[model samples]
Target chain A: MRSVVSILDLSTSEINELMNVADDIERNPEFYRSKCKHKILATIFYEPSTRTRLSFESAMLSLGGSVISTPDSKISSAAKGESISDTVRVISNYADIIVMRHPKEGAPVVAAMKATVPLINAGDGGHFHPTQTLADILTIRRTKKTLSGLTIGLCGDLMFGRTVHSLIEAMLRYPDNKYIMISPNELKLPEYMREALDKAGVSWRETESLETAMPELDVLYMTRVQKERFFNEEDYVRLKDVYILDRDKLKTAKSDLAILHPLPRVNEISVAVDDDPRAQYFYQTLCGKQMRMALIMLLLGII
Target chain B: MNIDGVNNGIVLDHIKAGESMLVYDYLKLGRLKCCVAIIQNCQSKKMGLKDIVKIDELIDIDLDVLGYIDPHITVNYVKDGKLLKKRHLALPETLTNVIKCKNPRCITSTEQELPHVFKLIDREKQIYRCAYCDVVGDNK
Candidate 1:
């Protein structure tokens, strides 16, 4: 009866269980290959997201599940003026589960209200991407081997990065995990998140200078400074390359430190860092698939 | 022109004239067993145009829901042709429990069993944000 809507929805115990399931899937691929056989996953993407949508589809297909999807909303009945609730209600009758991505902030919530099956929010506006948080958590745990007692640096696009917001919420649940937020004043984390962190008693600091905080961080999580997110071209031009992870920055960071980025990079990370032993972005991408597979199996009660 | 007041009931006054139906739908008052009256498009000196609703019994009205739907509603409790309590419902500083946020990508929106909670972050702005997603949307 549970649904994976937000990273916050899963308690510490449930998250550990999900990570354990993901770990098991990573260790034994053959055992879960046919876990979702004959089941259908309906991906109703109202917005454009190639990687997230493809990963979900690949994860389901890898588990022997079929995908019924509209990769683009322009091609779907949504272009004909159908409400998300109406579309999901009809889709729920045909599919066992629904994964939705919408431009509007609460489109997934509206769909879940009308859906009879489990609803997964792929992305909703600038609000939340819980599955991405799962991938991030899994990657963090795999890289660090522990979720607690680490000084994590979240740099760039803090305001609009849904992944960063969700990840911060997830990490705040762990004890002794400090945060070093590196972003310009305009792109600082929202007041609500800062308040939540304060309430949770998590130690955190904000700095526009990433170099000052780099050497102390156990994990440096970088996010793209999206041009579309900026209100104007001038702000985008001024701050877009403020925190690029080049060799100079990497020299300041600890050799044991891991660098993570939610992919589809736009020059925030240098291509040269691909060979660094600490660069785990490629591994993070693979973890996304396995984590999604685990999520699919768990949701379908096959695991 | 004077509309006949209900014999003994709760009266919701000062609602935006055309928004009475929205308030009704928001409260799901149509499903209630109590007798109800929706007076719309009435002339008002203060608000230009106003609406009123009268219910036959005392029900626990969710003030947060009222705040979200129409913060202007003034609730009046009438007993034996006398106003017992006449008060303007103030929006909560934080809406912990009342009114589900309409955002699906929000955690509270997707989880079937979780309470649909929102907090009133700014009263003057008529803004309510999802406690889970931090998605802010206007109520008015």
Candidate 2:
């Protein structure tokens, strides 16, 4: 696909191909560093996601490319009545590609249509974050050596976690990937997600008990439930502390289990667990840069 | 009961009662120079209550739209005051520019060049999803 709007846009083979490229870059970062010399990447973030915005900028900069970013929509012409359509069109001339994150669900899709250059959706509301999922897939591929044949445990907010949504959709294409869904009843995985899994014929078990599912899991993807994403304050207050992963909780998990989180995590993951050998969320962030680098090259048809 | 039959126009029969006005407005029947007659709430043997429209001239009508709004409608073509063809309506497999994609992230919202289109993914459930955003659209 010319534009990366959704993870599903890339076929399984294409995603596998990207994984290979990410592996190569992860091993030999220097070789790909100068690949995008003189090229420009524009990151337009309508929503303030520091990690995502910075990752895109770092990915571009590491590739010897320059970045021209409108980090905040309010700071950009959008505040002065400019639409995302016009903004993307204007930036298309200035940049080789665009990475966008917007509060509106389809804002990036709209920008993509108007862009002359390739577009990457960083994260569109609760819609999709193909890049982060790329980072996720890369981390999984690197750590586990395969995208298939593992039981993945997705914990915490399944309702508003776009990462979980994209990752589940991406991973289900593989063979024999079981999902252990751990969430409070209030924050259960949405019906549409269940329908997708069911439609794919993937076997998944749901439980409120993460400890019971921890031993069987190869990977535990913990997510934070932001108060803003929750509609009702009372529900948020009750469920936000529902799944706090401490060292005690990690004791139940397998020794080789990879713990993943799409971060800026609140209290979901304990700060005390950061030094644990299995806690790979930091590596996940660095892997995010590599994946974005590989992704930039792949999307630009460089590799 | 004394309404005159059409000479060369189309007759829409078996439209659900109280819904013919929607079809009438949607088809832009008022824009047509031909005489148009909307007979609403007419008693029918099969439908119990139905609406009918008789036109003086055969104007362009979106038959798919007629089916989408009220699938039970039947269209009859009149030629020189004679019955020409009778067409039964069925639900369209897809609809274009009918339901707006509510998902703000959808491509069509900003891409003015793109047409708002939806495909019927589940016939049994009558579920339609936007081609771009995958936002579900109601059958109605």
Candidate 3:
């Protein structure tokens, strides 16, 4: 069975195909209303996440599919000490497809190894979040019309943001997609990421100032400074408020720039910017559902 | 100094000087009951100095660990005091339970039964990344 543990699992052509399906789903929701009539999706969140879990549930329900979920690991069999392998093995019998989020990195990989059905990694600890990358790309495709030749400005926590990492990997597959990585010195992109960009021969530059990179970008992807990812509370507190995107900051940004945040955002993006048409983060949520629906259908081989 | 050749055994040659002890530790040579000789700092022409390990039994050793430690090392299988086959080494594609991941957030760290796995991502740099957390790890 196919399992999406990372963004690299899907080829560029496959991603484009999935996006095409997502676009069709967005335009004609009634056509896909009962596409997954009898299928059951298992949503297992080992970590407490409001947006991703709910998004998966909503996507399944919208497709006329049933969902069985364990939204909180604290109250599930995990709290009593069950391995991801055993849980997935059991869940596979009950569900046709599985989507999981875990605080431990590569937890879904373990689940994927044991699952009989298709497995989707919703999110993993400070690692890959392939679904969010799908959503970001879909949003970009909707507004920008092409995945290539755009200046993508990544702001806030580049170091520990799984969404940022996943997005960069996805975008690297396209041609001429320059990256302007804007983050504080302490939260700069990891050395491996820099090496990857250098190896790929992509145009990428790192800067401390978000405002400086704002004018050059076609897409500005903002990220939250997650408290859970930091080993030190002091570091999290110091960096959490470092890059707040208020309306004043947007004044220097391109009018056509699409602002995105893989959210449950905590003070990183200001409420004032929500009124701007350029702020597409909320709409990004809808894109997430559509892409997930497309992905579920593809993995289940129903479409 | 000279050591007796085993009738049926394996010989490890051309190990970089000062790394034989590491090879010994990694291969758990101390746990073996058979005769094992770790010859250190021997003369060499190809290399300035080298080490050799001679084992008195044809026991299976982890070639991946050996290759990761030093790819230049030569393995000679012996049967009845005659050389059977010579094996060369290269960095392994994947290593299972060979090295533990230090990343605290990796699934292998908490899961006691999970095999610690690493994959060679960069052959030029000899870089191996943990399969779970994608953190760079050394052979040590």
Winner by DockQ between candidate 2 and candidate 1: 2
Q: For candidate 1, what is the DockQ?
A: 0.17
Retained true contacts (fraction), each candidate? 0.23, 0.31, 0.69
* Local error of candidate 1 at residue A245 (angstroms): 0.6
lDDT of 2: 0.85
Clashing pairs in 1: A106-B103, A106-B104, A108-B104, A109-B104, B95-B119, B95-B120
Per-residue CA lDDT of model 2 for A1-303, tens digit only, reads 289888988898888888788778878888988999999999888778889889989989999999998846777787886777788889998999999887766677777878999999998767788888888877887888888899999999887788999999899888999999999887788777888998899889899998889899998999998787866799889888889999998887789898999898999999999999888898999888888888898878888
lDDT of each: 0.83, 0.85, 0.92
Which of 2 and 3 is the better model by lDDT? 3
DockQ ranking of the models: 3, 2, 1
- The per-model DockQ list reads 0.17, 0.36, 0.80
| Clash count per candidate | 6, 5, 0
CA shift of A51, model 1, Å: 1.4
TM accuracy, model 3: 0.98
Docking class of 2: acceptable
Best candidate, lDDT-wise? 3
Question: Candidate 3 — which residues are off by over 4 angstroms?
Answer: none
| TM-scores for every candidate against the unseen true structure | 0.77, 0.88, 0.98
Error of 3 at A51 (Å): 1.2
The weakest ten consecutive residues by lDDT in model 1 chain A span: A1-10
